[model samples]
Every structure is written in C-alpha cells, then in structure tokens.
Target chain A: MLKILVIGATSLIAQETIRHFAADGAEFFLVGLSADKLKMIQDDLLVRGAKQVSTYELDLTRLDKHQELVDTAMETLGVIDAVLVAHGTLTDQKAAEQNVDITLRELNINFLSAVSLLTILANIFEEQKRGVIAVISSVAGDRGRGSNYVYGTAMGAKSIFLQGLRNRLAKSNVTVLTVKPGFVDTPMTAHLKKNPLYSDPRRVGKAIYDAMKSERDILYVPFFWMFIMMIIRNIPERIFKKLSL
Target chain B: MKRYESWTRQPKVNHQTIVPLHWRDELPDLSQFDKLVLPFGLGRSYGDSCLNEHGILLDVTGLNQFIAFDEETGILRCEGGVSIEEILKMIVPRGWFVPVTAGTKYVSVGGAIANDVHGKNHHTAGTFGCHIPQFELWRSDRGRVICSPTENKELYEATIGGLGLTGVILWADIQLKRIPTPFIDMECIKFRTIDEFFDLSEDSHERYHYTVSWVDCLAQEPQLGRGLFTRGNFYDPPLGAKKEPRALPMIPMPIDLPSYAVNPLTVKLFNELYYNKQLRKKIGGVIHYNPFFYPLDAINDWYKVYGKAGFLQYQFVIPYKETREPIKEIFRRIAKSGQGSPLVVFKTFGDIKSPGMLSFPRPGVTLALDFAFRGEKTLKLLDELDRIVFENGGALYPAKDARMSGASFRASYPRWEEFADYMDPKFSSSFWRRVTSS
Candidate 1:
C-alpha cells in the first residue's frame, strides 16, 4: 500500500484526489487547518477503502511548524510515496488592493506557507530518492492581471519554486508536478458568478490523480487551460498592460 | 450569477439568490436571508420542483462528499449532494450497487429522496426512499433533525417525496445491494398489443429483477401498442473474467439542436427504427449496468436533443384494473394528438409499497412520455390526458410535472394537507407553490 501525505487534506480538490487513491487501500497522513473537517475527511477516506488515515491540525501559516508537520507525517505513515500540497485561499483582489494586511496574509497563506512545507518535503524526498510532490497552482499564475495581481503574483512565485524543485529532484527520481487549474467550481470560487468556463472540482481532482500516478511534471487541468494561458502569456505587454483583465 | 435550469429545461425561472454550499458544518445562517430557500441538488427534477423562481436556491451540489461505507454491510452514508454517479463509481468496483437508481445517474441523493425516485427494478426494490434507513434534515428552525422510520416517523415519511419543501437533507444513509459484477443478464422481447405488454409484464415480474418496455406511441390499430420489452438480473460474471472499468465518461452533447429538430415525423421514424432494431423474436445477453439502467446517461445533456425550447416529461400511473383498455385509450389519444413522443417508457409497478407518503408508484401501470414544448397546443393535449388519468384514478409525478393543476394534485395525493404540516416554513419550491395554490 502506498503511503501519502496530504497537506490540504480537507480541500475539495485534495479530498477528491485522495479518494482516487483510497480505493487502492493507500494509507494517508492528513494535515489541515480545521480539526473537524480533517476528521470528516479521515472517516471519508477510511470508508472509501483507505488502509489507514491520520490527521494533524495546524495553522499552516506558522512556518515554524513546517518541519514538525513533516516529521509527524513521516512517523505516522512511515514512508510517504506521495505528498499533495493543495490548501490555499482565494485572494479578494479588491480587499487586497486596499489593505496591506490582506495582501500580506494572502501571500503568507498562498505562497510562503506552501513553500515552507515544500522546502522540507523536497529535501526528504530527495534523500529518500522516490516520491511524488503535487502542488495546486492556478492558471492565473501564467500572467498577472489587474483583477488579481496579488493572487497571481503568489501563484506565479509558487509555480516558479515548484519548477526549480522539479529540476533539483528529477535526478533523484522525485516527481514534482505543478497543477494549474482554470476556473474551478470549488468553495473558493463559490462567491463568484459561474459560467461554462468553470470546471467541476471532480474533473480537476481526477486530473490531479491521473497526473500524479503518471508522474507528470506539469499539468493544465482540462488541458484546454494550456492554450488559454498561452494566448494570455503571448499578448504583447504594451497591449496587455492597457486592457483590464 | 449562473441561471440554473432543471433537466427538462422547461419553465425557466430566475432564483433571486443561489448559494452553493461546500461544507456541511459551515451551513449558512438561514435567518440571514429573508426569502425562502430551497435546497437545489443536481437539478434533475425535470420541472419546477427543482426551481425556486424568485426565491433562494441553496445549491447543494458542492456538498458532494462521502461519509462512510461498509464493504460487508453494503451501507453507504454520504452527504445529500452526492450523485448516484459518484456512488456507483465508488461502490461498483467493490462489488456493490445502489439498492435503487433512477433512469439517470446524474441525480443527487437528496433529490432522489425528496422525489422518491424509482427505477427499472422498482418492482423488487421499491422506491429509493424505501432503502434509506435514515437521514439528517437540517431545518432552518429546528437546526438538525435525524429522521428515520422509527424516529421522527412523520417527518421521515413526509420528507420523502416532499418536493424539497420539508428542509434541506444534510446527508443520508442508504442500503446498497450486493452485486457480483457491474453487468446485467438481459432478455429482450417484442410485444404488439397493450394486452401482450401487460401479459409480458406479469410474467417478467416473477422471473426478472428488472423489467421495462418501450412503447411506439404513434402506432395505430393492429400495431397500436407495438414495442420492446426488456428484463434483466445482475449478471454474476464467471470467475477470472475481466472486470469492467469502474466508470465510463459520458459522451457529451455539446450543443442544443434546432427547435424543430424533433418533430412528429422524425419521432415516428426513430420509434420505427428502434422497435425493429432487434430483428430476432427474443434476444438474451450480458450487458453493462450503465446502459441497462441509464441509457440516456450515455450522452451527457441528452435532453438537449429536444432543442433550446426544452421538453417536458409527462409520467403518470393508473391503478391496474381487470382490463388493459384504459392504456389503449391513453395511447390512442396520444396518437391522435399527433404530438408523438419518440421515447415512451411503459412499465408495471408491483405490489411493493414505498415509504414515501406522496410516492407516485403503486400496484399499477406507469407510462412516461416526453413532449417538446409547443406552447398552448402541447398544454392542451397534456390537459386532456390529465383529465383521463384523473378519471382512471391515476396521479401525475410531481417531480416530472411543471404545470399540474392544484385540484389534480390534491385529488391524486390526498395527504398533501397532512404533508404540508411537516414542511419547513422557510423551505419551498416553484412546483410546491404552483401545485398547492393554483
């Protein structure tokens, strides 16, 4: 049975991905912000056929506890075959633009906290010589936009960090996958107006699971997001900077 | 905000507020919203029952999460928003299946319970609510109430087929049936008359676990009720056989066809071809469960075939009398109206009683047909059919009805007033309002 550690265990996408592995009797060590939600996910995973599931409650923004989180997971699961870092907040661009505290908090949760965990997991996986490290980034990371530059910047930074990690861990056989999902109909986007563009979380979850199992380095969930992002990236900077996106 | 449509895509109504909830523990404070709120599932109720018009829709699709499942007991506890498709994906590989399923796998468990959905095997398993041992109903006033047959019995029975007027079902514990494999041993036979169909139905009930028929609504005289009868049992694949994949992606219907794409002439031709597709007198084989139970689910948004104007499914059940004469009269009226529906499902509901107080199925003959909305013409035809059904002591399925009159509803479901007593004051739907006060 494969042992997996999921950092955002209660996240809709993370829970969905974990379910795919659960049917195979994979063991899980879950880390999340809410104890109640994590407990629910643990029970969910157990019923779905997980061999074992353990949860740890923590405010992930406290970078000081990153190492302890990994240590606990290593102790509980013994050998982690995969780690999915999927917890993050949807930054309110309006609030972020007006308040430095809001902007900083978004950065702390979306970028720095993830980097803290990845730094520890990367070293452990490099030393162990095998494992999958999957992170959920956003298509907004492809290019910063006026609508959400704060969130875009954080996701861009996380994507770049994962890219470097993938380069460093390649020779060690540690697969680092950066999943860039487009507009997903998750709780994070629940307040936004939904359209045909928003993909279902289940679809995104299945894509993550498939990409992790196949050991792919980068994935544009729904695949169409790849072309959509490419178009945005190629837009001339002069024209891109003028039009509100 | 997204404008939501029910499966039938008819009677489009704008819900003032749409709240898509993700976590059960984080249920919003109901008192904050002034308007009545109806929990919306997969929105597959075919009509206005799933719509709230100008009120609030607490979209529950985001609450799709499983709580527990026991391999030995075949009992699954999951959030109400979990779809039958998701359940099948999880349990089929584990050698278990839903105790009862509708014609479509897209429906959420809560919607299924609220409507008390029935399936091909309803003769044996009864309605979906029959197998629901218990569920958690979160009322705006009462907070969370655990409803079961033995506890809160009145509310439990009322919530089933209560048309989303009771409260939002938080989660449910369903009893699943064990299956050796996700395949069915199916037998198909052809029938030429209503009496032959009735005879075949009577015989199949004793021999088959699942049974249904396709009737040619356009047929006349000698071939008045010509159609195909199909029956099946869960196939126990021989040991060492290759196991089928857990789930197959449904082929999507990306766009709606033109409004005139499904006219009577086209329907007649389609029905003719479908009836003659099986050349042999009788055919037997092993078929996958997906097509056996949910043929339309094979194509995502199959209803789009009826085009942008949308369609309405008219399904009703009349008690089986000593004669098969009433069905012929109903079929003749349909044929004469020239509003032929290509997909007409004819089946017999057995003696199995549903726990739902307003459940549509009984020991009777049930007929379901789809008609593309043609404004007044279509409504007039259906109104005529309603009078005939009411006269025959039949009732319309509220889940599939968009315009059933209040008198007809009251006449059919005599317990409406009793059921109304259990409904949450803050919970209501367009269907409820239309049927209760029209």
Candidate 2:
C-alpha cells in the first residue's frame, strides 16, 4: 500500500488530502499543530477506511524537528511513498507590515519550513529514488502585488525553490509538485470578500493528488489562474507598478 | 514570408501578454525545439492551454494560407494557422461559412482543433475536432506524423483537447459543413427561470439549427437564469440582410473601467435593464452571420472592462440528467455570494462524447460565469461551487478552470493516466511546472 504523509493535516486542503488518500486505502500519517485537530482527521480517515491512520503533533516552524518527525513517521508507517507539504500560514499583510515578528513568522512558516521539509524529503525521496512531494503554493506567487505581496513573496520563494528541486530531482524519479492555487475557500480566507475566481480545498486537493499521480511539474489549480496570472505578470512594469493589483 | 493586406491584429492571441516570436516562415524546415506552443489566432482560451511559457510558442498565423477547397463537397484544406476571419473574408463572399464557430472567429484552425472548441452548433455539429479528417502533428519524440481517426488514433484523440500537450499541429484537412447562405434568420425568446430556460433550450433543438442563451447572473430567485434565447438558421438575401461588411475598424475600450465599476450594485442594475429590454414575448428577426457568430469580436480588448486585473471565466458542465438542479444551486450560490460580475450564460449541450478522455463535456447543460479579480472570499465561494459540481458528478472545464484541486482533477478526469502517459517528456511549461512541482 502507498504510504503518504500529509503535513499540516488540519488545514482544509490537508483534510481533503487525507480523505482522498485514505479512501484509496493508502496508509496515511496526518501531521499538524493541534492534537485535537489531528485526532478529528484520524477519525475521519478511519471512517473512510484508510489502510492505517496515524497522527503527529507538528509545528513545521520548528525546522530542527522536521527530519525527526519525518523519520518517526516513516518508522511508524514504513516507507513513505508521497509527502504533501500543505501546511502554511496566511499572514496578515497589514499586521506583518506593522510587526517584524509577524513578517518573520510568515516567512518561516510559509517559505522556510517548506524549504526545510523539502530538503529533507528530497534527500529521502532521492535515496528511495521514487516518491512524490506536493507543495501547495498560491497563484499569488506569480507576481508581487500591493495587496498580498508579503505572502506572495514567501510563496514565490517556495515556488522557485521547488522549481530548482524539481530540476535536481528529475533523474532521481522523485516528483516535486507545486500547486499554485488562484484562490481557495478555507478558514484562512473566511473573512475575505467573496471571490468568483476562488476554488475549494477539495478542488485543490484533487488537483494536487492528480499532479502527484501524473508527476506534473506545476499545476494552476482550476487552470484559468494560469491565464489570469500570466496577464497579471505580463502587465508592463510601468503600468503594473501603478495598479493596486 | 507571406503577408496578407488585411488589417490584422499584429499579435492575435487573446492574452495581450504574448509577444510574438519572429521566425522565418520557410516551413518543412523549422527549428528543432523540445516543445512548441501553437498560439493560434485569438488566444481566447482562458488558460495557458495554448501557451508554452518558457518554451517556443509557434505563432502559426504566419503559415495562414488556403491550400484547397471543394465547394461542392464542402471539404476544405487549409494551413493550420488560417483564422476563421480569413476564411469568412474569402468564403462568405462566395456564400459559405464554418460548420461550427466558437464565440469568436479570431481563432485559427490549429487552436480550434487543439481546443476542440464547440459553439451553438455543438448540440448539432459537434466540435471542430469531429469535423477534421486528419492533421499533421510535429512531436519532439516521434517526429512529424499524420494523425486522424483511423491513423494514429491515440495521438489524434490526445491532440484534441489535449491542451496542446501532445504536439504542434502543422496543417489539417477539415470537412466543412455548407450553409444555404451567409446570413441567418434569427428569433429571440426570453425565459424567466432555469427550468423554463432548459425546457425551451431542449425544445428548440428539434426546431432550430442554432441556439444559445445569455443568462443574467445578477437576477435572483424567480428571475434567476433569466436570459434571451436566440435560435437561428442560414437564410438568403431579403430573408436576411447580406452579412455585415468586415469593417476592419478597431473598437478598443476607450479606457480601463474604474476598479470598482463591476461590483454588485452596477451589475444588478445592468442585469435588470438587460433582462427587461429582452422581455419581449417574441422578437423574430434577420441578422448577419458575423453578429450572430462573433458578437464579442466587435469590441476589442473587452476584457479590460474588469480593469487591469483580468476577469476569470468559470465554465462547468453538468450531466443532462442533473442540469436543472445544479444550475439552480450554482446561480443561487452566486447571487447569495454578492460577488456580482455578469455575462453569465447557459446552453444545452447535444449528444457528443468528449474527444479527449479528459475533455470536459457530457450529455448535459453548461454554464459559464465571468468574475472580476476579487480577493479571498470569491475563492471560498468558488470552492463551495466546486463541491456542488463534484457531488453532482460534474467536471470543471480545464480550459477555463484555474483553481481546481489535484484531487478534484483526478476525480473529474479518471482517465488522466492515459493522457499523462502520452505527455512529451521534454514538454514542460509554466502551467505544467506549477502542477508538477511543489
């Protein structure tokens, strides 16, 4: 059976990820920050008939413990077939702009943590020469905008890092999936205004799962975001810098 | 290099972002690239399905040329890059038209086939892919080869709605459907509810040669899905005015609409007036084929209405059996969400199996809605809609979907593995990169 580890299992996308893999009879190790959240997910996976469900209380920002967590999860679940790095913090741009600590935390959780986990998982997957790593990035990474450039910068870094990782891992048969979602409905975005371009976590999860299975390089969850971002990214610098996009 | 005197849009793809790559038009002797994106006439495709990103995007319009035509047989052979506008310019004067035309004639033969684009006639004639007898595809791995229904069938199916992932289409021999004339006899019927719209749409199939409906998204409850149902057929002379002269006059949106111009208040007002104006019990009329087929082509850069932040067009198809319910639900959700951006449309699809295993279509009803770039809440609502679509066993259209999850994609297109197996190893794109890399 496939062994999968869904980091940030408490997130909406991660919840869908757990359901998808668990439903397929794959063994899953759902890791997150809150024990209660992880247990709830474990119960859902069990009810969905997962091969085996395990929960790990994880704080991805504790970069030092990332490898140990992977090692422990591997020890508990046997060889890892896929690793989904879905954990991220949607740091408030206004708050971060005012507080250095908030900005640092956003970077650490959104970019640095994924980088650390990917580095470790890349090595492990390289050793195995066969495993998939799915990273949930946002279309916000396509370009920096006044609205959410801080978060965009973090995702952009993650996207670029994953691109490099993908290039390096090409020969190793290790698939690195970068999911650039346009907009997804999640608790993180509940307070925001309704978006016509928004996508659901399940849709994001499906796109990620499909990308992993197909070994796609980068996927615009929902797909239209590719054009939307392409247009946004290509806006001449003279014009783009002036807009509030 | 061949150049026509027509006042053509220098770079025809819909994405104003594309800077045409100049190359020698001497064909049969092209560059050796790992992969090339064929950007046909109007890059109308909502996604990069037509873009190669960092790879070479072969601007096929340069190869635009009419190779052969059999007026009697209605069989036409043309260069892959020939645009429908180019065809209409020549053939419409000679009394002929495309068997099927998407919302715009700006698309090239290659883009049309690559997208397997359907139009009002989809319920009758099927997609452009279905009419193609065969096409020449240049694959990085396999080299140049001819593919058709009976020859290299897999490659043929893969190329259509394959999102150009299969290879570059060189030229094609397509069987065109002949019409009595270049003009159309039209009729407009307005409906109040989703149920009435579907009923009329289904009933119109037996009585009309062409049919399409424009739904007003801002309308709520009783007025939901209210739209002008237009059905028409080709007619001669006095029956219909000679098709509108191709006035090469460019009508660009004078200025970018104010950022907040398309919010709920304005859209509601616009929808109310638009609905009332089309509230006529019956409006029988005769119209030119150009206005009937490519209405939006008259207004260039129309997307600028959403201001610099281009809008997103979400088109989804639900099976015929579950059409009314989901559409009602989808409209209700949109109305309740207060993310009002209009130009919502609903059309009944006829019987035609999707060309590609993962192509988006079934015996069903399809709805398309346009939304301006709003922040997070818009995404959340779309996510909720995605769940509704999933639960109904409907699939989102890949050509227009940009926010679908990998899991949802897998579930929607179960035969994705089959399409994946044919993906050119060297064929990598930013879109592909985004999906594959994490």
Winning candidate number (TM-score): 1
Off by over 4 Å in 2: A1-245, B1-41, B236-260, B433-438
**Clashing pairs in model 1, backbone N/Cα/C closer than 3 A:** none
Estimate, for each residue in A171-243, the C-alpha lDDT of model 1 and write its tens digit.
9999999999999878888778887888888888999999999999999988999999999999999999999
lDDT of 2 by residue, B1-438 (tens): 112111121112332222232111233332454344344345567754544544555455544445556768777766676678767765665566787787878888887887678888778877777788888876657767788888988888887777666766667887776666666777878788888887788788987878888777767888877777888788644555544533322211112233355888887776776666644666766666777777778767667677755667788888757446776888899888878565665788888775665566667888877787686877788898889888898888766765677777778878777877876554544444444443
Q: Find the candidate with the highest lDDT and give its number.
A: 1
Superposed model 1: Cα runs more than 4 Å off = B1-3, B237-260
- Clashes (N, CA, C under 3 Å) per candidate: 0, 53
* Local lDDT at B417 for model 2: 73
lDDT of 2 by residue, A1-245 (tens): 78998888877777666566765778998888888657656655654447788889978889999889989988998899998888897879999999999999999999999988888888888999998888899899889888898899999999999999999998898888898887776667755764577765667777777788898889998898888888888899999899987
lDDT of each: 0.87, 0.72
**Model 1 lDDT at residue B373:** 78
DockQ (CA atoms), all models: 0.53, 0.01
TM-score of each: 0.95, 0.57
